[model samples]
Target: MFNEAVTQGDDPGAAAAAHAHGILPSADFCEVVLEEPKADSHGDLSTNMAMQMAKTQRMAPRKIAEALIAHLDDKTGMIAQTEIAGPGFINFFIKPAAWHPVLTAIHDQDGDYGRCDLGKGMRIQIEFVSSNPTGPLHVGHGRGAAVGDSTANILKFCGYDVQKEYYINDSGRQIQTLGLSVYLRGRELIGKTVDFPETCYQGAYIRDLAAELLARDGQELFEKDEAAAIMPCARYAAEKITRGMRADLVDFGVTFDCWFSEQSLYDAGKVAADIRYFREKGLIYENDNALWFKTSDFGDEKDRVVVRQNGQTTYFASDITYHKDKFERGFQKVIDVWGADHHGYIPRMRAAVEACGYRREQFDVLLVQLVNLLRAGQPVAMSTRAGEFVTLADVVKEVGRDAARFIFLTRHYDSPLDFDLELAKQKTNDNPVYYVQYVHARIASIYRKAEANGMDLGGFSTDDLTALSTPEDVALIKALARYPEAVALAGAAMEPHRITYYLMTLAAAFHTYYNRHRVLCEDDLRLTRARLHLITAVQKVIRNGLALLGVSAPDAM
Candidate 1:
């Protein structure tokens, strides 16, 4: 793919002369500066080669353009036109013939048409939804789950060996609170007058966990004194909540290759080993009875404590070990998807990674902002402590796995999302997800109708796709041609929202074509056959995209 992009833009002869004269141009620098076909104000493809060369040549941009144009050749594929526009920007207009082969390529490659090997076989691990075991996942965690999972899929498609992981904050004060909450709830169910503390997890899942414990252990856990029962019940509750969380994430079409336990770092001596390594490296120090990392040296707001005065490790400590362990396992890149609330933690984690002798860039943190879930038009307050928040499973049950996953990933992870249940449940065009899936299903319906009438839609396969020349049809084909470029952009940027946006645009084009043109015209057999081929190609592309997002492309409405 890079070769194709390079060959389509390379000006080697120009590069040689420019290099000899110390007048190397921008065109000689980068292989391709892709221009959006729709944003043609920038040209089919545009480069500031002349402008860049002006600095080296000590000449004006117009002179550079003239020199660059002198070396420009017709070898740039599909380039029907090329000229300098606005301050030495070289703009090119591509011919339709240049784009027509992409349709046949789409048909030949089918769903795999847009996939590329851009990652060059690096192993990347994406860890997300490391929500505590104290409660079920709320909408915020759901958004992180969607972003992380979809990102892993995208990277894998782009030739990265990607591992999807969920970090479980299973060992913490939060889980202890959950255990106490369950014990108190069990005591309450047994008619005790114990007061439930404000810090205890008050979610209904805790109550459910308590009931299950009472039924299974026959009140023996509660019969023991508070000290004896607290830790045991806490472990039990954490396990139960973790199970429920795993099930909910699975139902939401998000699966993790690993469920890393924060406790594991301590249990395996990794935490102490990491702290000792830091201490030996002079990065760790004891101050005010707390062990601190010299994170300030690496641009952190302040030095952070690895172990608090109370002798418990801070989240930073656990995270340091977890990240070290990830690198130890040979993952070339460690990607973490976190909510916006943890935006402050990014600097600290990066500092820790750098302090541990690894390049900070090896750790990529994607900050997923909050999701304001709505029922009708009102914001729904998600309370994890009260356990009244909507679970990912609940959302999937309400709108379906496909709709839930697609909607969750419909926006940039760094931007807050408004997930309205009413909008997602709509079966009409107002629902963006269904609009895309409907295009796939509509094409399937047309084929079925053709089969019912004994007309083989597959019987005609010709190279003359020029027969599909309607404005709408051409529009759809053009959209299809951009899929590979779109995937490449999204993968390179680590942005999955681009795929969602691409699907919406592609779906709109298909809907417009469907409404304006008839694919089964009796008198125009050639045109009909060509249009059917185009629609089939569109369907394949849509289905493949939906699969990447973990959404369904149904064959029927």
Candidate 2:
């Protein structure tokens, strides 16, 4: 709707004025005015380009604002009013007509309402939930999985060629610990009283793996030399845990396109080859019995070791190869979703990418903070030692995958999320998943009831959406119009939680409309049909949003 104003030679954002004034010019820039919402004083969106350029151009801000305003088409329908407020800050009052077209567009496009050509099909890789294959995913891993999965979905909707990946840590010390843990448990199961080390896994799943091994191979596996058998046992345990982890994620409705292995980097000599590249480029040097990369030069706290004195690669070493491998696959952008506890690792990894000759900005990191699972009002403590840490599968079975995914993403990725078991299981407003699904099911109910009444809505074209002019109707349409913007913002910012919040707000507006007014009133067919059009659009958005979160959008509760 606002595009008409731009096409009419009105103030076309800051870029045009900047170019005429011999200032920095960029086609990518837009002049946005932040005006009060006419209801809230917190200005809907604020930009200070005019004020910033006043001194550089040797002109007063108010004068510059007047010139910019002259170019702005007064016929811009989205702007009910535009005024210079507070030292050249242009504020705009978005007109209701500006929100009306959204309803028609939604009815015309259906579920594809929010998709845009913003990315122009740029290839992007998103790697997340690369948790070690030593145990089931904890709550921390759940957050990353939700964020990464939703992010990829949003990017795909925005016309990006997105590939979702999960990196497996199969060649690490954690795998060794898992092997020893399984072997020790196997020894106990076979009538040996070996002391089980506390450092090994004590989860019941490990015992189950040991049981499976016992059932399949008997005690022959453990009869071999300890050192000789440890690696094989660990490999077996890792495979079992990895399989279980995959099943758990699938149960949670999460799937990845690739499961890249850390072992592959070693098997292919990719890590060694990358280290040699750094060595040849003088990006790495030996100091104090350690092979250190010049990470400090690239913005790390200091230099980091690629290889330890014992001739083993560090975690950072495998990571360099992993990142390089991702870039070499021809993805223009790589996004990593990690638990916030690993925030410190970002700078180093970013530095490694730059040192390896890739653009530092090519790598994006989304730090998903912790989730505190709650069962009533109390915190749910997780412990692997007690064999009581909640698995992703357990959460899915308890509250369901749709509920699990939505609740996990209900908060901003940077903010701490509280997942209440009781609330998630509730069918009312306490559960956002149910609320959104209720709207979808209600729309289906309308369609069924209308069909039974011999009312053919398929013949009703959306070209007559102007019939929907009530305050609530317009409000609902406004929410529908924001879908594309919401999607674009979420993709650009790498924030999937925005969609969760949008669904909740949209669902609330829908339920409120449902409670107050009937969509199939016999005497009001025109308004009823129009409202159905809006409801149908709402259903598409709710279903699409839920799918992005790896949640199910059921037609019936």
Candidate 3:
């Protein structure tokens, strides 16, 4: 309706346009945006269409607003009244009947109420939690997993063809270090006096891997040359650790469409091929007896080496190849979720993307910040290198997946999160997940009560919605109407926390409405049925929002 008013206001044949000498041209030049006014007395919805067209129409904003409102086509009687507010803002007071369709649409759509076609099925890949398979996943990795997985869900809900991927850094020096750590532990198990280098991994998991290796391969492993033994140990330990990582992720409700290995890039000769391609494109050159990418030319602070003087490729080389392969596989957009420490790496990666003939905007990186695991407001000690950190599995086991994932997504991924173990487990409103899930449970209880009361368990008709004309009822419906907008914004910005925030807001609104009004009134069945239908829509939307975050909406708290 706001769009129609703008079009009519701009039509040359309209009286307002003729009065203004037909200065207003096509409405396409400016976008018409409608926002709910904070104060109900102001109006139901407000728009700045007049101000937006003031410059284009060569008229004062107040005059444009008057002209627009005079020419508004409220043919369906949707707008009960229109007011010109300060600074030429148009306020619309929509009739009570206008909000009924939103309720009907909610019932018609159900689980898909908030879903949008923003992406139009664009192929997008999101790679996250690519933690090295050297140790168990810590709380930091848990945060990344939640953020990445929820973001993927949001994109998919917005009609994007999204593939969740985990890139395995299962090659090079780290694996070598993992192998040597296990092999040294194996030697100590065999009673051979060996100096355990300080550079070796100190995790207890490594010792466990060593013990398993000794049991599988026996003492013969120690008899082989240390170099030959290290490779076998490396392969065995990486496979085991990767398997455990996969299982932990599955338990956390994050399953990847692909478990891409960094080693595969080398084994398939893609790394070497990428370097040659870059060199052919003059994006790579030799300097200091090493191959360096011209990242500086593409906005990086300095050129970065892809190959060392010792004839070994750096990790950056593999990353370049991996990203190239991602685009080659027909993904229109690629998103990498990395630790906050990798913030500096973004410029270089963007440079590489541009050099590969892709736009800088096509490649995105979501830098997830650190997570501080706390118990009762006291920090829990964690050292990944020393194997003293709390594992993601331990957190999930203690707080459950729903709580952990919800807490992880309560804030933007770029902001550091403090996951309070005690707070997450609480059933009170202090616990965000519990608070939101309770809304669903409470509505289910309402339905059960409605059934027990012998009222028709069958749904209400559209005419019943006219009973939902109270300010509280209108406010609740407006809140429900914002769900699709929240989802669309979240998908556009690639931020899943928006959904979390929306869920909390909707939950609070429902709780407020429930406390003030009785849904199953004994004296008034019409109002009761109307309120029940309203709450039913609320429950469905809450479930839909929670599903996007990979959190469950329980029938009972």
Identify the leading candidate in terms of lDDT. 3
- By TM-score, the better pick of 2 and 3 is 3
- Cα TM-score of candidate 1: 0.88
lDDT of each: 0.81, 0.80, 0.90
lDDT for each residue of candidate 1 in 517-542, tens digit (9 for 90 to 100) = 88887677777788888888989889
Can you rank all candidates by TM-score, best first? 3, 1, 2
- Residue 414, model 3: Cα distance from true site in angstroms: 0.7
Which pairs clash inside model 2?
A: 10-71, 11-71, 11-72, 13-31, 34-45, 179-234
**Per-residue accuracy of model 2 over 1-557 as CA lDDT, tens digit each:** 13222221323355456445533322222455443244434233444556875654454666555556656665554555666777877665556556667777776787788888888999999999998988888867877788888899999998999999999999978888888888888888988889987788888988988899989898998777677777888898888888988998887777889999999999998999988888989999998888999999999999999999988889999999899889899999999988888999999999999887799989999888888989997999887676679878778888887888888898899999999989999988667788888888888988888889987555566555667766677668767767788888888888898888898889998988788778886786777777787788888888878777778777776
Error of 3 at 493 (Å): 0.6
* Candidate 2 lDDT (Cα, 0 to 1): 0.80
Which parts of model 2 are misplaced by more than 4 Å? Answer: 1-98, 385-387, 456-464
Query: TM-scores of all models?
Result: 0.88, 0.86, 0.93
Give candidate 1 misplaced runs (Cα > 4 Å): 1-34, 37-93, 458-461
Worst 10 residues of 2 by lDDT: 1-10
Q: Write candidate 3's Cα lDDT for 44-109 as tens digits.
A: 989997888777666677777776776676778898889999999999998887888888999999
